[model samples]
Target: MALRVDGDSPQNFSALFDLRGTADTGELRLTSPIGSTLGLARWSPAEAVLDNGSRTYRFDTAGELIRAATGADIPLDALFSWLAGQDKSVPGWRADLSQVDAGRINAWRDSPLPRAELRVIFDTP
Candidate 1:
């Protein structure tokens, strides 16, 4: 994943991730390029938790956990919808699905200040 925020330096991340279950209840594991575990996150309606080897972080809602990691409040439901080939509008973000057929997606946010961009590429149909 790559993020370019207006004032902050661009942030680039390369990881193998596994996301499963629904938007409200799921597990997200981020692994480094060399196959080492970076962090593991699990969430349910009741709670959200992130284990990063050295420490654990907990929050009341999954959104909080996500925001803490991404520095943006991305809607989980919208993300899932996009992965399924639908364009779900997000308040401050725009998504380019033109290349989705080729396993590429581009999204950007310009509202609420600190414009940012996110890109995702996958190797699957």
Candidate 2:
């Protein structure tokens, strides 16, 4: 996932995430841009774990772990649906799906502070 958050501190974070499981049980592995293993995040209804290289970080929720790692307030679950071309509405954000057929997605946040935009382009596999 290549995420660029432009607001107070402009952050360009790109990671490879393998997401597996349902709402009750799920695991997500995040890798560096060069494909080196960065961390493995596993979560169930009652537990969440983030194993980074030599250290392990635990959080109350997957969202918290993700936020701590990425420093961006992104809606992970909704993002999966969005990438699938679903029109999921995240509060304070709006997406443009008109060009999704062209392998592109553009979204922006207008409320709760500095305005930011997110653009995603899927590479042909």
Candidate 3:
């Protein structure tokens, strides 16, 4: 995922996500190319948490947790659906499903300022 802030608070980052678990509850671990852990995001029905080894933060929802961590509000539900080739729609975002058969997907958030993009490439079983 690539996050870019368009205004005065401009920021950018791209991380490879090691995502696991179900739609309702799961853990997402972000890491650098050299195997250094950047952070871990965990969510359950009760709450959501982000742990950066040295500090821990909590939020009311997974969306909030992700927003705090990435400077973007990404819809986790729609993200999972897109990965599964479900063509779920996320407001302010557009998903390209043309390459799902090749195990790849691309989604972009073009509005509400600070445009962002997400790409997923999965192993074909």
Candidate 4:
């Protein structure tokens, strides 16, 4: 999957996802050259889950998670930032993150470091 954010808006972002692989135990194990084996993502028609062992993230099909494991509401920017920081090999889209609501920003501030598992959502072209 490829994600592109245009302008300073998270809503302006575009995601392209290409899924391949078999489903096992309600999980879709995809192998993409852009991702790592440690990255395990599971998705169903209603929800998406990403588990990296220490942290588990659950998001709606719309790519919005009600709350992170830290009990914090991760803003769109911080979420992308945290994800970008994980694998440096990912493209340079990190520079596009924009300011979000203060309430959302505070959720991730001073929070415990996230586990290696990073869950992302993309629109299938």
Candidate 5:
């Protein structure tokens, strides 16, 4: 596992993920120096569960079952668009879509229900 910032290599890094359960599920939580959650990816291999808190999203990755759950063939672009739209309601939250690289975009575009990005911003009190 690696962490990058603004497309540059990260100077500091930390992460927590557990893969010991029978469900084969794990959660990754990473925070940058600026106090923003750079990434959070979770998956349940047993049940094909996927979720990312930054975007308030939850979905299953159980093959065709996921499509059935959503009632549609959801594309990666649509998922990212949906996640981006969610930031609109978050008072201090913002996402820099421009910073997303081609590799990242392609990876998600190719996956059935890929991980979502969340670039959090902190506001002064």
Candidate 6:
């Protein structure tokens, strides 16, 4: 994913991920190029935590956990929708699911200042 937040330089990242469970309580695992685990984020209503092999970090909510890692406020609810092929709209983000079947998804945000963009590539079972 490549993200451009209005005032800051773009942030780019690529990984193999597995997101399981519901938005309220789930696990998001990030893997490296050679298929090694990089980080694992797990969240519930009361708390969110990330175990990165070496250490662990904690946050108050899933949103905070995401922001801390990606520097964006990614609504988990909307994310789940897109993953399921729903073109659901959010206040500041627009998603292009046209190529989802081809293993790609693109989304961008342009509201509340510090505009941002997100691109994802995945494999479907």
Q: lDDT tens string, model 6, 4-121?
A: 5554666666777888998899998999879999899999998999999999999999999988887778778888778878888899888999988887888888876567777777
Two-way lDDT contest, 3 vs 5, winner: 3
Q: What is every candidate's alpha-carbon RMSD to the true fold?
A: 1.8, 2.9, 1.7, 14.1, 15.2, 1.7
Q: Write one digit per residue (lDDT tens) for candidate 4, span 1-125.
A: 22222223322111233334322223434344555444456655677687755687778641343233223233433444433332222222222222232111111122232212223543312
Reference-based lDDT, residue 70, model 6: 78
Candidate 5 residue spans exceeding 4 A from truth: 1-23, 46-54, 62-125
Task: Give the per-residue Cα lDDT of candidate 1 at 59.
Answer: 93
Model 2 error, position 44 (Å): 2.1
TM per candidate: 0.88, 0.74, 0.88, 0.28, 0.26, 0.88
Clashes of 2: 0
Clashing pairs in 3: none
Candidate 4 local distance difference test against the native: 0.36
lDDT of each: 0.80, 0.73, 0.82, 0.36, 0.34, 0.83
- Among residues 3 or more apart in sequence or in different chains, the pairs in candidate 2 whose N, CA or C atoms overlap within 3 Å are none
Quote the positional error of residue 103 for candidate 1 in Å: 1.8
Q: Rank the candidates by lDDT, best first.
A: 6, 3, 1, 2, 4, 5
Worst 10 residues of 4 by lDDT: 101-110
lDDT of 3 by residue, 8-82 (tens): 677777777788886589999988878889999999889999999899999988988988887877889998888
Which residue ranges in model 4 land beyond 4 Å of their true spot? 9-35, 52-54, 62-125
Residue pairs in steric clash, candidate 5?
A: none
Q: Candidate 4 vs candidate 6: which has greater TM-score?
A: 6
Output candidate 5 Cα RMSD. 15.2
Clashes of each: 0, 0, 0, 0, 0, 0
Regions of model 6 farther than 4 Å from truth: 1-6
